[model samples]
Target: MVIRDFDEFCRDITDIYESTLPNGEGQVASYIPQLARVNPDQFAVSLCTVDGQRLSLGDSKVDFSVQSTCKPINYSLALQLHGEHIVHRHVGREPSGRGFNELTLNHDGRPHNPMINAGAIMCCSLLKREGEVNVADRFDLVMDTWRRLGGGTRVKFNNSVYLSERTTADRNFALGYFMREKQAFPTSTDLLETLEFYFQCCSIEVHAEQMAAVAATLANGGICPISGERVFETKTVQHCLSLMYSCGMYDYSGEFAFTIGLPAKSGVAGALMIVVPNVMGICTWSPRLDKLGNSVRGIEFCRRLVATFNFHYDTL
Candidate 1:
């Protein structure tokens, strides 16, 4: 909790994140009008060590949509419920090596991995059980995870954002139907209900501290360091973080894996979270996106943080 190097790293990251913005470049995901109004200049960074030290930088308190990063958390929940062997039958563990919108699945239409849209839909479908009361109950379970992870305060529903995603969600809808076609989805699954839940989950806004805590839970083998509570099963967490390591970044997963050497995930809402086992967990937010649709400043902050802090786990 008291690592001197981490204390200094926080200072540096805070300085960088506080000083940058979207500038005149980078396009927002405006097909959803709710996303269009995000202050392009907003940015934040939050970090926590495995021992529970907290270092907050920039607008780490500012709320932002959870976006695709929700996939792995929900994936963890799915694994906890269904077990690894059953879940693997429906979703592949490999990275898709393309943008998130690409609807094609594996040769068998099994989702390429849980980190992508297709895989996320599949994960959502897997959440639907025969005895489940309704979609809200499932969402409540996810919210319970958020609460235990210290992100409860940051959870806010931007109705407009949800609606906007629904408006432009034809690609996502197509993915669900295509999965259904290939037997990737259950015969009794309700496509629209699943899609709505997925979109709403993506719209849940969380601050960086909550993100850091979530990452720390993964770092600590599924236990929240701050809350001292177990959220998901240990094996399920391992599976989730492993996928984040391989496919968290849509098309840029390869480059990020090669360069960062930390298991991380990014959201279209400009939130990027990284987890280093027993070392630290970090989250960065900058609304300006790079060509890969990742946060430009967020990635820049992580790159600099990794470079300055000696987090190249694989090289060493």
Candidate 2:
């Protein structure tokens, strides 16, 4: 088994989950009204090892919007559809060192990386409607990918959250226009279609239980642990995880890399997906967010997790 003494490991995880419950700092993300109204006190942690061991605590089964946590999956799909060379042509692989939604591009006139809004929007544009008839077909392809990543678990769409995101998407719209102005997007890219697709991707909903399976797929080198199916090429996962490590935490990327030493992505909806390559995948969800837009209880849970286990990349 990937985690020896699985029963003992689960007990340790339970202890960490209980210890993180009293944290009441931070606020729910209010920019999106639907997200703002979520129960901020709710917290959950779920994990799945590469060998298929599983554990969940608190509100692990409760659904929440995926939000920015969708970036790595979308980027992976784009890489699988088009090779790295083609994908990187429009999006760089370096950290942006700015806000996740900053109106900036690299010196080469590309979005810094696929983890940020600009780069994620660029990735949405690359998922061409080839072979797919309409925008819904394209989104169906994305949903299919998410299902594969989640070990064939049912993934749901949140039309309300999608509408909320679309309604409050002025910044993303601005990003699309700015990229078009810079000639960054592919020729004939439908700016409106791309932005709506981005919002739709963000609004997909899943509970921590499902997201842990998704993370485990990445941890197991793009193979779903439960289904034992290869969902992505190994090289695609390597590239995606590398960027998630360096750029996934918004402005806190550097600090998170330095301290946690694990590849993780945090969404404003208070979802944190973490991968311990060749070992396990973890997902923590709590709607109370820090100023940096990370989940307060989720961050605490991760801190405790690493301190208890030698999961840190730098750990000898």
Candidate 3:
């Protein structure tokens, strides 16, 4: 099953995608009104090799909210801006056994890691903590980074998703205030602004191919293969990959690490972004989700992908 060339790789991807299409085993996320309305049958699979070879299958051009897939990028940005030591001071690099929106923290008064809601909120607060940049400027920075990560493609914010998230973000707000009570946030950090920015990031929209490019950027050690531009420090990507590997797929992180063996992040929007470091990036979208809030087709695809290719880090 070695994919010796781009054509073979593309063929295999399409084959795998088609084979997995009939399982239709999960439900669309109904908590968010916008997400709940998406077609549950819509699916896409995209891959971008380290050398910039790209392939897509199914509804690859359809756009959807990035959801929690934005966590790793936002975490990387905060680490790049403030360094690991300072960032770790606010969020621990550990997995939360609970769900993504749990109002919990580690013993040290920090969110377990940047992949969960609490940690992500802390990461958002840390983004412009120096107060040198306004919230608008900070958001622009995030969007600019996302665009470059997507290989210079345009990625937009879905206002409907943003509004939906804002309306149903009671848990996130509770997490924020909980962290604030624990003094996990920075001294000058504004809770409301940080939470708003976090929701905005989660609302960013991109197709499967674009998200694959973003994952490929991280796979390429923060250098975009297509653009030949450095998007983040190598150390930043390293830190993010580490956290994503350990905590990215909500509470299913441990099992995914054992089976898929890749650094990846999953969003409630049924998006999965995987990084096969030094090899390629893979993105899969299916609006239907398993009970654990992961894309059912996406999880199956990763299993099939590693079984078909030498993608598992251990195998490589």
Candidate 4:
């Protein structure tokens, strides 16, 4: 089961992708009307090695909303700019043990971690927001980061998805206001602008291969393999990946860690970005989701991936 070379790795991944094609056992996310419309049968798997070698199969070039998978990247940016100490003051590193969007906070009034809705919102507030840095500037910075993380590929925002999420995000509003009431955000935080920024990050779109590049960057110690650009600092990537390992899969994080044993982040848009440490980064997309909001086929691919190769951190 060892992947000695690129061809073998491609062959094995193709086999696994095909094997899960017929087993569409979950539903596309319906709460977000835009996501519910994605073709449930569309599936893709893409991988990028530390050396920048790449492979993709089935709809890998098709674009989908990056969704919550952007959390780790956003968190990384926060840590890079604010440092771990300042960032952790607003958001803890522990798992919430509840739904990703559940209105909850730790005993210290901080959001549990940056992977969930509350924490991500807090991370959004931590981003530089002041005079001369308008919403457009904020958008450019985040999208630019996503582009570099995607190995210089263009990553777009789905306006339809953003509008839909913004319109229907009462839960997010509640979470934001709750944290604001608890005085969790910075003194000058603008709640509306922060939530808008958060929605924009969640709505950024990337193809499967593009997301694999982002994951590969993390796996390669924050260096984008395709471009050889240092996108994030080593410690920043470490902190983001650690939280992703513990809390990135919503309520399913614990089980996913136990079984797949990789640092990963999942999006409701049916995407999973997985980091294999010094080995590679993998991305899988299938619109069918389990109750906990993870892509079912994406999880299956991770399980098979670890089984076929020594990709799991614990195993290594």
* RMSD in order of candidates: 2.0, 1.1, 1.5, 1.6
Q: List the residue pairs that clash in candidate 4.
A: none
lDDT of 1 by residue, 1-316 (tens): 4466665766776666654543446776666766778888776778887778888866878888889879888898889888988888899999987788796788777989999999998888888576674888898888777777663344666677788888888899999888888888766788889899999889887888888888888888888888778887788878888899899987888888889877889999888888887677788877777788888877676677667667867753
Model 2 scores a C-alpha lDDT of 0.92
Each prediction's total of clashing residue pairs, residues at least 3 apart in sequence or on different chains, is 0, 0, 0, 0
Q: Rank the candidates by TM-score, best first.
A: 2, 3, 4, 1
Q: Candidate 1: give the clashing pairs.
A: none
Give the per-residue lDDT digits (tens) of candidate 4, residues 58-150: 999999999899899889988887898998899999989989999889999889999999999999998884444577877788999999998
Off by over 4 Å in 2: 129-133
Ranking by lDDT: 2, 3, 4, 1
Model 3 CA lDDT for position 114: 94
Candidate 1 matches the true fold with a TM-score of 0.94
lDDT of 1 at 249: 80
Determine which window of 10 residues in candidate 1 has minimal summed lDDT: 16-25
lDDT of 3 by residue, 1-316 (tens): 1236778777888889988999889899998789889999999999887788888888999999999999999999999889999999999998989888887889998999999999999999988857575889999999999999999999999998899899999999999988999999989888898899999999999999999999999999999988989999998999899999999999899999999899999999899999999988889999899999999999999999999988888888
Best by lDDT: 2
Measured by TM-score, how close is model 3 to the native structure?
A: 0.98
